[model samples]
Target: MKFLAITLIVHTPHPATGVVQSTTERFREVLDNAVLAEELGFDGFGVGERHEWPFLSSAPPVVLSHIAALTSRIRLFTAVTTLSLLDPVRAYEDYATLDHLSGGRLELIIGKGNGAAQRELFRVTPEDQWARNAESYEVFRRIWREDKVSAVTRFRPGLKDAEVWPRPLQRPVRVWHGSATSKESVELAARYGDPLFSANVTHPIEPYAELIRHYRERWRHYGHDPARITVGAGTAGVYVARTSQEAVAAYRPVFEGNLALQKSLGLEPVFTTLDDFVERSSALVGSPQQVIDKVHRYHEQFGHTVLHLHADAGGLTRTRHHDSLTLFQSEVAPVLRRDIPDPPFPWGPVLHAPAPAATPLAR
Candidate 1:
C-alpha cells in the first residue's frame, strides 16, 4: 500500500499547558514536518485546507508551492481542497502553476468542505455547497484537461473563447474526490471515473466501507472498468511502538484530550476511548504486528490502495511524532507494501527520479 503522511496543522494550545505556539512558529513547524516527511521516505505529504480558528491551513497551494521548492522527490497532495468555496478558474490557475513549480508532483483531493466557519468565509450555505462543489469541479476539470474552455456557471465566471494560461505540467492532473458523508462526491467521482479518497478520520470503518462499496458500484455503473478505479483512505490516527500496551498508554492521553475537545464543540464523539478507537475506529495505534493487522482488516473491508495516516495530533511533541513516523516507516509500512495489492495508479509517475536541476536535496 502507498503511504501518505497528512499534515493537519491544528491549534488547540499545548495539551500539557494552555499555552499556544505563535502563528509564525506554527507555520514553520508545518514546513519542518513536510521536510522531515520527505526525508523519512514518505511516499506522499498532504496538507489540508481549513478557514477557521484553531487550524492554519487556509492556503494549501501556497504552502505546497514552498514545499515543492524545498523537496525534490516526495509527491505533494492536498488532503481536501474546498472546491465548493473557491472560484474554479482561480483554483485551476493556482494549482496548475503549482504543478509546474513542483515538476508535476502535485495531486488534488477535492471536497465539499465541512464547518460553518468556512461557509461563512466563502458566503456559501450548506444547501448550496454540494451543487457548488460539483459545478466548480466540473469547470476545474475541463480547465485542466481541455486547451480552451468556455463555461457559464453560478460560482465560476463565464469564459468566452479564453484559454487558461500555463496548463498543468501533467497532461491531466490526477484528482481524487474526498468522500466523507456526501453521496454527491462519491457519485461525482464515479461518473468521472476519478479516484476517491475517503475521509476516514472521524467515524468508524463501517460507514466509510459502505461508501467505498457504493463508489465502486457506481463506478461500474458508469461503464468504467472496476479494476481502473482507485481508492485512498485516511485513518483517525497512527502511532506504532514496540508493544500494544505501551502504545495505548502513551496515546491514551492525547486521544482522550482530543475526544474531550470534540465533545465540547458539539461534534460527534465517534470513539470515546483509546481501546474503543483501536477496536472500532481506524486509529492504528499499537505494535508492528498490531498495526499490520489493523491495516489488513481495513483492506479487507474497503480494498484501499493508498493509506494516509495522521501520526501527530493534539500537539504531540516532536520527538514522539518522529518516533511514530520512524517506527511505522521502518516496520509497518514495508509490511503493508509487501502484502497489499498494487495501487491502481502508476507508481512511475510518483516515484520516478526527478531531473538533476529539479533535485535540490543533493545541494
Candidate 2:
C-alpha cells in the first residue's frame, strides 16, 4: 500500500482559537511539512489547487516546484488540479516544467473542482464544469502525449499543430481522475484506462464504494483489462493514538472547531458529531489497530492500493499532530503494507531525462 500526505493549504483563522498565521508562515508551514513528509517516509506529498477564500493553494505548480527543491524521493502531486478553471495549454506547460524541475517525480490528479465562488470566478457554471473539465483534460492529455497537437476546443482556443515547449521528464506521467460522486469522471477515467482517486471524505462509505464499483464496471465495459485497474482513496482526517479513547478525546475538539467553521461559512456539516464522523465518514480517529481495521474494511470495496491522509494539523497543536503521524508510520503502515498488495505501477516517474524530441508518449 502507498500513502500520501496531502494539503489544500487552507488559510484561515484557527477554528479553535481564532488565531491566524500570516500568508508567509502558512506557505512555509506547507514547505516544512513537505520536507517532513519525506523524512516520515510517505510515498508522496500532494498540494491542492483552489481559487477561493480561506485557501492559499491557487498555484499548485509553484508550490510543488519549491517542494521539489526541498525533497528528493517523495513524489509531488497536485491533490486535484482544477482543470475546469485552467487553460489546458498553460496547465500542461507549468506541470511539465515542474516534472523536469522535480527530477521526473511528479503525478497529477485532475478534477472539475468545487466551490461556488471559484465557479463564478472562472465563469464555469455547474452544468458547464464537467464538459469543460473533460474538454480541458482531452487537450491536456494530447499535449502531454504528442509533440504537436491540433484540436478544435470549446472552452480554450483551437490548436493547430501547436508545439508545446520543453517535453516532460517522464516518458508518460501517471494521471489520476478525481471523482467525487461523478459518473462522468469515472467513465472518463475508465475510457482512458487511467486510475481513479475517490474523494471518500464527504459522506459514508456506501456512496464512495458505489462509485468505485461503477468505475470498475465501466472499465470492463470499455474493454480494459480488469487486472490492470488501479484506484486510490482519500480520508477526511487521521489522528492515531495508543487507545481509541485518547484518539477520539483529542480529535473531538478539532472536529467541533471544523463544524463551527463550516456553519459559519454557510455550508451544511456532513457529519454533525465527531462520533458520527469517525463511524460513518472516512476520518481515521482511533488506535493504530482500529485505523488498520477501518482501512481494511474500505479496501474490501475500494480495492484501492493507494490512500492519502490530511497533512495539515487542522486545529490540533503541531506537536500533537506530528506525534500522531509518527505513530501512524511506526505502528500502522507496516501492518497495512504486509496486508494490502502494492500498486500495479511504480509510484515515481518512469524516466528521469528528456524524451526524444518530437516523440509522442508510448503506451
Candidate 3:
C-alpha cells in the first residue's frame, strides 16, 4: 500500500513546554515536515486547508507550490481543499501551475469543508454546500480537460469561450474526492470515475467502510471498471514504540488533548477510553506488530490502495512527534511493506530529496 504523511498546521500549545510555536516556527516546521517525509521514504505528502483559529493552512496551492520547488520526488497533495467555497476557474489555474512546478507530481483531493465559520465567510449555506461542491467540481473538471471552456455556473465566472493559462503538466491531473459523512461526495466521485478518499478521522470504521461499498457499487452502475476503482483512507493518529505499554504511556496526554478539542467543538467523540481508542479508532499507537495488525484489519474493511496517517504534534512536543515517526519508519513500515499488497498504480519509483529545515510554511 502507498503511505502518506498528512498534516494540518494547527497552532496549539505544546504539552511539554506549554509554549506555542510562533507563526514563523509553525510555518518552518510544516516545510521541514514535508521534506522530512520525503527523506523518510513516504510516498506522498498532503497539507490540509482550514480557515479557522488553530489551522494555518488556508492556502494549499501556495504552500504546495513552495514544496514543489524544494522537493523532487514525493507527490504533493491537498488533503482536503474546500472546493465548495472556491471559484473554480481560479482553483483550476492555481493547481495547473503547481502541476508544472512540481513536474506532474500533484494530486488533488477536494471536499466541502466542515467548519461553519468558513462557510459563512464564503456566503455558503449548510444546505447549499453539497450543491455548490458538485457544481464547482463540474466546472473545475471541465476547465482542466477542455482547452477552450465555456460555462455559466452559479458560483463561478461565466466563461465565454475562454481558455485557462498554463495548462497542467499531466494531461488531466488525477483527483480524489474526500468524503467524511456525505453520500453526495461519494456519488459525485463515482459519477466522475475518480477515486474516493474517506475522512476516517472523525468516526468508526463501519460508516466509512459502508461508504466505500456504496462507491464501488455506484462505479459498477456507472459502467466503470470496478477493478480500476481506487480508494484512499485516513487514520486518526500514529505513534509506534518498542512496546505497547510504552507507546500508550507516552501518547496518552496528546490523545486526551485531542479528545478535549473534539469535545469543545460539540461533536461526538469517537473513542471514549484509551483501550477503545487503540482498538476501534485508527490511532496506531502500539508496537510494530500491533500497528501492522491494525492496518491489515482496516484493509479488510476498505480494500484501499492508499493510506494516510496524521502525525500532528497535537499538543505533543516536537521531540515526541519525531521519535514516534522515526520508530514507525524503522520498525513498522518495513514489515507492512512486505506483508501488505502494493498500490494498484505503477507510481514509477520511490523518490527522495534533501531535507529543507529552513523553508517556512503558513500555519
Candidate 4:
C-alpha cells in the first residue's frame, strides 16, 4: 500500500499545554514536517486548504511550491482543494504552475469543503454547494486537458474560446475526489473515471465502506474498468508505541483534551472514549502490531491501496511524535507493504527509463 503524510496546518493551541505557536512558526513546522516525511520515506506529502480561522492552509499552491523546491521525488498533493469556493480559471492557472514547479509530481484531491463560516465567506449556499463543486471540477478538468475551451458556468463568468496557458506537465493530471458523506462527490468521481479518497477521520469504517461500495457500483455503471478503480483513505490520527497498552496510555491525555474541546465547540461527540475512538474511528493509537491490524481490517472493507496517516503532532511532544513516525516506518510499513497489493497505476511520479535500442537482426 502507498503511504502519505498529511496535515491541515491547524493553528490551534497545543491540546495539553495550551501554548500556540506563532503563525510563522507553524508554517515553518509544516515545511519541516514535509522534509521529515521525505526523509522518513513517505510516498506523498499533502497540504490541506482551508479558508477559515484556526487553519492557515489557505494558499496551498504557495506552500507546495516551497515544499517542491526543498524536495525531489516525493509527490505533492492538495489534501482537498475547496473546489466549490474557487474560480476554476484561476485555480487551473495556480495548479498548472504548481505542476510545473513540482516537476509533474502534482496530484489533486478536490472536495466541497465543510465549514459554515467558510461557506459564508465564499457566499456559497448549502443548497448549491454540490452543484458548484461538480461544475467547477468539470471546468477544471477541461482546462487541464484541452487547449481552448468555451463554457457557460453558473458560478463564474462564461469562457469564450479561452485558452489557459502553461498546461500541466502531466498530460492529464490525476485527480481524486474527496468523499466524506455525499454520494454527489462519489458519483461525480465515478462519472469522470477519477479516483476517490475517503475522508475516513470522523466516524466508523462502515459509512466510508458504504461510500466505497457505491463508488465501485457507479464506476461499473459508468462503463469504467473495474480493475482500474483506485481508492485512498485517511485516518483520524496516529501515535505508535512499543506496546499497545503504552501507546494508549500515552495518547489518552491528547484524546481527552481534544474531546473536551469538541464538546465545548458544540460538536457532537463521535466516540466517547479513547479506547472506543481507537477501536471504531480511523485513529491508530497503538503498538505497531495493533496499528497494522487496524489498517488490515479497514482494507478488507474499503479495498483501498492508498492510506494517509495524520501527521499533525497533536498533543504529543516533538520527540515522541518523531519517534512514533520512526517506529511506524521501521516496523509497521514494511509489514503492510508485504501484505497489501499496490494500485495498478503508478502511485508516485512515473519515472521513465530509456527504451531499449533496436538490435541487429540476429547478426
Highest-scoring model, TM-score:
2
What does candidate 3's lDDT look like per residue over 1-363, in tens digits? 788898888887765556778988888888988888888888899999898877899998998888888899999989898888888888899998888888989899999988888888889999899888888888787767767666666766577678888866776778899999879999999987899999898677999999999999999999998768899999988888889998898888888877776777787887888788887898898988899899889989998878898746676567877888887787888887877766666664223322322111101
CA RMSD of each candidate after superposition: 6.4, 2.9, 7.0, 6.9
Best by lDDT: 2
TM-score of every prediction relative to native: 0.94, 0.96, 0.92, 0.95
Query: How many angstroms is residue 30 displaced in model 4 relative to the true structure, after the best TM-score fit?
Result: 0.5
Per-residue accuracy of model 2 over 1-363 as CA lDDT, tens digit each: 999999999987887788999999999999999998999999999999999988999999999999999999999999899999999999999999999999999999999998999999989999989989988988888788778787887887888889998888887788999999879999989988999999998889999999999999999999998888999999999999999999999898789888887887798988998889999999999999999999999999999999999999988889989999999999999999999988888776777433433312222
Q: Write the per-residue lDDT of candidate 1 for residues 36-74, one digit (tens) a residue.
A: 888988888999999987688899999999999889988
What TM-score does model 1 achieve against the real structure? Answer: 0.94
lDDT of 2 at 287: 97
Task: Please list the residue runs of candidate 1 whose C-alpha ends up more than 4 Å from where it truly belongs after superposition.
Answer: 311-313, 348-363
Name the lDDT of candidate 3. 0.83
* 2 versus 3: better TM-score goes to: 2
- Estimate the overall C-alpha local distance difference test score of candidate 2: 0.91
Clash list (residue pairs), candidate 2: none
lDDT of model 1 at residue 33? 79
Model 1 poorest 10 in a row by lDDT: 354-363
Candidate 4 lDDT by residue in tens digits, 1-363: 889999999888788888989999999999999999999989999999999877999999999999999999889999899999999889999999999999989999999998888999989999999989988988888877767777777888887778998867776788999999989999999988899999998889889999999999999999999999999999988999998888988888778877877786679989988879988999889999999999999999999999998777778888888999999999999999999988779765543423322211101
lDDT of each: 0.84, 0.91, 0.83, 0.89
